[model samples]
Target: MLTRTRMLAVLLSGLCWTQGAWAQGSPTGPAVVATIKPLQFIAQAILDGEGSVSALIEGSDSPHHFNLSPNDRLRIEQADVLLWIDPKFEVYLAALFADTAASESSLMVTASAISGLTLHRYPDGELDPHLWLSQGNALLIAQALTEQLACIYPDKAPHFRAGLDQFRSGIDKQAQALQRRFSNQHVADYLVYHDAYRYFEHDYGLTHSASLVADPDIQPGMREVLELRETISASSPACILLEPDASPALVNTMVQNDAVKRITIDLLGNSLESSANAYRQLIDHVATGFLSCLNI
Candidate 1:
């Protein structure tokens, strides 16, 4: 599969750029590329450069449901380093990297390989691969990327290490700030309109039982709806966290129960928040949103 990606390198670097930028390969330093926006954002934060880091995934698109285009294949091939979450979410990426591991030597980093990660299994018992939500896991991710970047660009080891240390310290500060602000809140559990918070829950010691949809891309069935209603009634979650793309009807049903209120959980930057500042900013937003609603 990676061989095919390598073969397909004849396409374009997966980053959405002017046709001119895609045509121009790296002039200097390692060309760090990632499969998703969050990974790309983290890499950019730690590894400062002018077009040195690139993202293969587009904004506002879910990596779980991604289909590799010709451009995506090329981006993998051209990348000196490719960082991604576990193969579970981007299953195709594993096969791509595995096939070309010998030839490409892309110096890939797998986000889930880090120790102390908590599992969020589906009914079928598979690893939920959205590790970016947890502050601790994001730290682990930054550290791993820093180490990998050192290996790839040994000349930049000092710079990369310093940046990484700063990144780690920044993560700690944000976590502490959130702890200080939210310490009084005993938010043991909440109900998500979907299953995107396992990593967040694991990191902050929060428990979340989501109102399961029959399929991530589809609606919940009657039985699933009834079960969720029961969960909401019994749990009395502070608010029902609803993603922008999630079904409004499901949220409405739960909120109308009088046991829960509807709260917007902005997963992506919309008309409200802009492009995104740092990895920690996303975590801060999560903490702020939950705290604001829960404290209410």
Candidate 2:
């Protein structure tokens, strides 16, 4: 079976070929490129009828360690506006940005740059780059991308602004509802396969007891595994969250004989079709996972 990433690559390649042929004789808006699916989804929302958006890395691969191909690099160079979370999250993109002449076209929306965000830092004092996990950050993403699109196609500023306002309204209601849903639940502590939900947790006032891996690409050492095992055994958390893109074997090995319930959460919206409401659906999907796991 072709993975989603490969499938998207083939589809986008075909589309690019078709679009390239058409562009030879027609005037078109600048191409928008994003580093991942979530960013692509947000960009798509703002660009709707104005232009198309493409993602460099697709499928289940973690952005933390993705290796860009020649085509991917070409997309970046050709993009009129490039959006990514930050180099801390997509570490490989940092060098790519520096090496390529596309620096002037790229925007890094880190937590610090965005106002009204509750940022977190790792023990090493590095900022958490998972800003998209929080609803507030999602709003920030939509606003930032709207500004980019407006600049690129100033004639469509009204369209972009209207879309941004609609998105803001929809997400505001959903965020309030999600907060109510999680707040009503009594399960304050839970376990996760990866430490990717701290932003969400912080936003919702949920507490994570332990994580199987701090970095998705790095497996837990034996000592760390034992510690997590002990923590789970001691707390017997009501729910253990796993990333849909991660290996189920890792979650199984961690849980072993524990009676805890397991739930899969997809933060990247990989399974969702890109649209204006894709981010909202992604948030709802994650909320459903938490609600199902907590039985609230």
Off by over 4 Å in 2: 1-26, 99-112
**Candidate 1 wrongly placed segments (more than 4 Å):** 1-27, 116-124, 186-189, 234-236, 267-277
What is the lDDT for 284 in model 2?
A: 86
| lDDT (0 to 1) per candidate | 0.64, 0.70
- Enumerate residue pairs that collide in model 1: none
Best by lDDT: 2
- How far is 263's C-alpha from truth in model 1 (Å)? 2.5
lDDT per residue, candidate 1, 25-89, as tens digits? Answer: 34577677777766776777677653366666565566667678897787677776678776776
Q: Could you tell me the lDDT of residue 113 within candidate 2?
A: 50
What are the models' TM-scores?
0.79, 0.83
The digit string of per-residue lDDT tens for model 2 on 1-296 reads 32324323432332221222212311477477788887787777777766678878777777876878888888777666557776667778877664442233333333235445568888878887777778787777677667645544566779989988888898889988887887765774678877777788787887778888887877878888777777777777888888876677777767775568888888888888888888888888887887887788
